[model samples]
Target: MKQAATASLLAFTAGFVDTAGFIALFGLFTAHVTGNFVLIGASLADFHPGILGKLLALPVFILAVAFARIYVLGREKRGHDGAGGLLVAELVFLSAFLAAGVAAAPFTDADAPLTILTGQLAVVAMAVQNAASRTVFAKLSPTTVMTGNVTQIVIDAVDLLGGASAGAEIKARLKKMAPPVVTFALGAMAGALGYVALGFWCIAAPITSVVLIFFLRRGAASA
Candidate 1:
């Protein structure tokens, strides 16, 4: 139950940050690599001035994942939970992202170094989350992206409605998958609305959630 709650909160954070990045950074998707690829192609064809930042995001994301994997492996070697360490790293990166965005307010210059730097920080934080979800929280449903989750939800719904013999199992699957999807949508909505109202300060929502997750894990470990 605790794991599920934590995963849901992480999903919410991903959605929140991704949406905020999209709006604040001019269509950049920190959490969605596939979308970034499409945007890159479009930018290349249209000669978009921000193409450099978009092009850089993919490699930065990959490097972040590599760093996270090494960090997690080292922690496991020393007999500790790597997930907590990864979460802390993510929080730090996100804080840096928010700080950079604030310092670079009115992102009118797409080619500005600060604009690219802030975008890179957001992508790096989300890449750590992607790696952590796959390694540290492998047992939990993915919290960064929604494509697979939605597919599973549809399949499970069909099986349940089709009167599968494993009704309880299907129900359990639904319970595990539904909350994150719903919360992610809600988070995206909140992210958009919050950005309109609070600008970069909107990040406080996800930052608060990550802090809660860290403390919750600590409490669980202590207990």
Candidate 2:
């Protein structure tokens, strides 16, 4: 139950941040960084002012992932749950993203320096999440990206319907995979709506969710 709750919360955060950034930062994908590659290519054929931010997201994500891994590894070596510390790190970056975004709001130019900085801050926060998902939270279903989760869910459903797998096993898989996917979708919608209503202040929702996760999973030692 704890694992499911945490996974759902993280997925919600990822979806919320990704959508809000996309709407506000001119198609910038803060969580699904690879999606920016498509935007970058499109921008080349057509002209988009935010192309620079898209171009920079991949490298920034890479660096943040490396940092997250190292930080988690160091904590594991000391016999601590690295995820707690990483959660704090993510919260700090998210807070920074919110502050930068609010200050940089009314983004008239996507190529402007502040716009790029704000987008990168979001990228870093999601990168930390991506890395932590692979490290400390590896036991949890992925929270940021839903492609693989949805694929697996479909496969499992088909197998269950065909009786190709044991009923209990298929049900178990569905239970594990469904919540995050659903929550992610809901979060994406909420994010788009929140951005439309509150602009960058919408980020406060995800920040609060992260705080809840941190407390909910406190001292679990394993996720």
Top candidate on lDDT is: 2
Query: TM-score of the candidate numbered 1?
Result: 0.96
Off by over 4 Å in 1: none
Colliding pairs, model 1 = none
My TM-score estimates for the predictions, one after another, are 0.96, 0.96
- Candidate 2's residue-wise lDDT over 1-223, tens digit each? 8889999999999999999999999999999999999988887799877989999999999999998988888888888878888899999999999999898789999999999999999999999999989998899999999999999999999988898748898898899989999999999999999999999999999999899897787645454
Candidate 1 differs from the real structure by a C-alpha RMSD in angstroms, to one decimal, of 1.1
Q: Looking at model 1, report the run of 10 residues with the lowest lDDT sum.
A: 43-52
CA lDDT, every model vs. true structure: 0.89, 0.93
Residue 135 of model 1: what lDDT? 97
Model 2 residue 125 CA deviation in Å: 0.4
Per-residue CA lDDT of candidate 1, range 1-223, in tens?
7788888899999999999999998888998866877887887678666677888988999999999999989989999879988899999999998899887887997778989899999999999999999999898888989999999999999998999999999999889888889888988999999999999988989999899898878788898
Return the TM-score for candidate 2, rounded to 2 decimals.
0.96
lDDT measured at residue 10 in model 1 versus the true structure, 0 to 100: 92
The per-prediction CA RMSD against the true structure, in angstroms, equals 1.1, 1.7
Clashes of 1: 0
